[model samples]
Target: MQLSLPFTTLLAGVLLALNVNAVPVAQQPRMVTLPLKRMEVRSDEHPRILLQQQINRASKRLALMTGREAPTEAMMTEALRKRVLEVEGPEGLERRRVGLFGATKDKRFNRTGVPKNGKRSPKKGKNAGNAGNAGATGNTGATGNGGAAAGSSAIGGPDSATGVEVANTPTTGNSLGLNIEGPDVGYLATIQMGTPPQNYLILMDSGSADLWVASEACQSTAGGDCGNHQTLGSTSSSSFVASNTPFQVTYGTGAVQGAIIQDDITVAGLTLKAHTFGVTTSETPDFADDSVPFDGLMGLAQSTLSEQQTPTPVESLASAGLISDAITSYKISRAADNLNDGEITFGALDTTKFDQSTLTTVPNVNTQGFWEAALDAITVDGQDTGLQGRTAILDTGTTLIVAPVDDATAVHQLITGSQADGQGGFTVPCDFNQSVALTVGGTVFAIEPQDIALQPPNQDGSCTSGISGGSFGTSNTEWLVGDVFLKNAYYSTDVGKNTVSLAKLV
Candidate 1:
């Protein structure tokens, strides 16, 4: 009873079977946009505290890029402490702490988790207060008011601890809204996860590559609760699958350690099934601060830069045919401008955000995974400063520009009345208005005078230069270019092309 058939027919049947079992073709990709919310700066926040945080964050970012362990917080603080003593004498350190932590009548500084008077000012846990908005859904402008869930709070109101007003009701579209916390802070975006979908606000960081969130059992490295932020895990999501792989990432200000897992994640009306990410069991206190607006961070850098060795969320979207191109664009807004219209677009550029005719594309030079490009020149008042052949890393996560010590000194020297502040920064007269422009890819972009000088805590007529001097890992010719410079331009990164484009804002 053997079956008989022509050779051509048999071959045709075999081919048909193979086609049925083979992988399906990817669908066409479309552009997706997300809204960004801006978190205002706290009236009580000290400039010195922000400065130190930026310094530490820059140091950590460099270390991570170079595959080295960053200096311990104690070591970094000790170095700054020595500088203070050398410049301001014995009492300078205490005075600095008082300014940063706020001084009580008795002259004692308020340290977190430390006893104030006889009672301890306990750190707020995740369940202590209401969780904010459950996140906006669809393109209809529907806002979900979160219940008294463990980590829920009312959206579009002042944060319970920080008193920073958060925006509510993101515009309807295939976009997730972004929140800009402050001038120097990074942006945050809302995302949905799990079977039924739970909303969480996470940082939209392009400087690093890895997605992570706190788990239900998470604790602070300081041996306390993990703040009043949201948490996710197998308990909250029935579809969560544990990978049993250990993961750890250390930032300049904080670190997290946990296990890698898989689940469904949705952003901007697109979903990635079985997406891989980290669930932190422990984190540093910097991230566990109750004032911190985001629950976790989602890195938008190249996959090679991922500490977990997994594809980034954007990459996953491209692979799944969710986006046509691996492009991410940012139109960050200034708090002082009060435009409140910052946004991030994935897959394609929002042509309306910038002048397409002025777009200048440059090759990304750092093969080790940063969005770095060459700095052609520096100009002050249209006069070339002779600074050339240096490179700049366009980092959205950072707040200020950190350049090599020699380069920073040279740039500052060109400005009148600019002097070293002895704290790795420079101070200039508040009224020193000059056109400072940076040349890249033969295109010149000017930085606003206001953006170059920030008011220091002293209320004196002097300002702290937004560009500071520091060493980045082992590269003395590299610059960490942050929002200070980026806010002046329309920035976009193309992973597929391995290039970065900047254009004058419209």
Candidate 2:
């Protein structure tokens, strides 16, 4: 069960050394382990529902940006089943390809003019610009390939795009523990900030790389919805320095606007002096809801993904020598109760939580701060479906396992009585007992049926499919493996080495 790291491509970033089988115990001090807990926001809100909504929204965003027509509920269901644009024969495929660019099934199906792939259509054509655009830009859904991360805002990309950007830079050192708030959505950490070290609750998001909180000088939309929450008062902190740098960030949930500033921060017994962060001047309606539990979010993605234009907490810790490497590990508890049992460790892996020497490390393909890897194929019940040539983004921020329509459909087809529910997911018999696994770096990792069965059955008592339909970008094969897959695997990421490893949790 020795962990094997196969280097395909090398990129600049932070490094993470888990219980490397080769790294002796004395040398493992470079890594640090932290306890994590699942914070439950609403007892009634199932984790699948919350995370599914995020995936669905992200999928629509990709479609809108790509200029795809809004899909009908029926159309979406078919797409999830990978039955869209079905070709019955060679003639049908040719006709379908012609219709793919712009021919609708209406009377004009045979009359409208559409060019072949990569061929430019007439300037007056509605899909002129869309033609030859095999390479579209945007925060792709799980099915995106060879594209920057969704909402990347990469070095040269738009400043306010989807996905987090990865920048190779040193960090301003600091450290502290976070308060576990809502497990149904995610975890929240309490960070000590300001001169007197006022405690501020923030969501610890590995998918994002920006640290922000509501400021006492903030404004909200209508109802006192700006969340009846505490704020970080600049005047109250003697060490606060206002930068007035305009800052804004968007998430699947909502967006926030504020100014960048530098202040002292503390977490997990580590103090970061003059750490740069954002103070919210305005927030979206989503944040203002009273149901929202956390005050702000502290991003732990790679430094390159930081939207505040500064180093992330882990990067800062690495720069300050507080941790050995730029690595993070998550152990999300699958318990439905508010046990607060999940743990997120920085700078190291918790040997207690994973099988001994069972780690498998793969190269990260994208530099946009997403923990993505090259996927070989997927197997259901020990049969390969040839779902290859795709990249898998290991997202802790997401709840369901999202894949390109075809791959998702293929996986769902293996299960008996699984069919699309018209809401970007499939409905399956709650009693499904099959093995679904993904082959990565030549290793086969199986997902238990219990993990794949989403809770809270429909009126018919059938459960929702753990696999959802979505595209990352122009690519037809991008996969987003969220908590559904992670709950069954020990996931770890090393920013320094640009590698993501997965081990079957014992």
Model 2, C-alpha of 271: deviation from truth (Å): 0.7
User: Relative to the true structure, how large is the alpha-carbon lDDT of every model?
Assistant: 0.64, 0.54
Residues 147-176 of candidate 1 have per-residue lDDT tens digits of 211212344443333333344333324655
lDDT, residue 212, candidate 1: 92
Worst 10 residues of 2 by lDDT: 15-24
**lDDT tens per residue, model 2, 461-505:** 788777888754456556767667777777888889988988766
Q: Pick by TM-score: which candidate is best? A: 1
Tell me the TM-score of model 2: 0.69
The C-alpha stretches of model 1 lying farther than 4 A from their native spots are: 1-29, 43-49, 63-75, 82-92, 95-172, 472-475
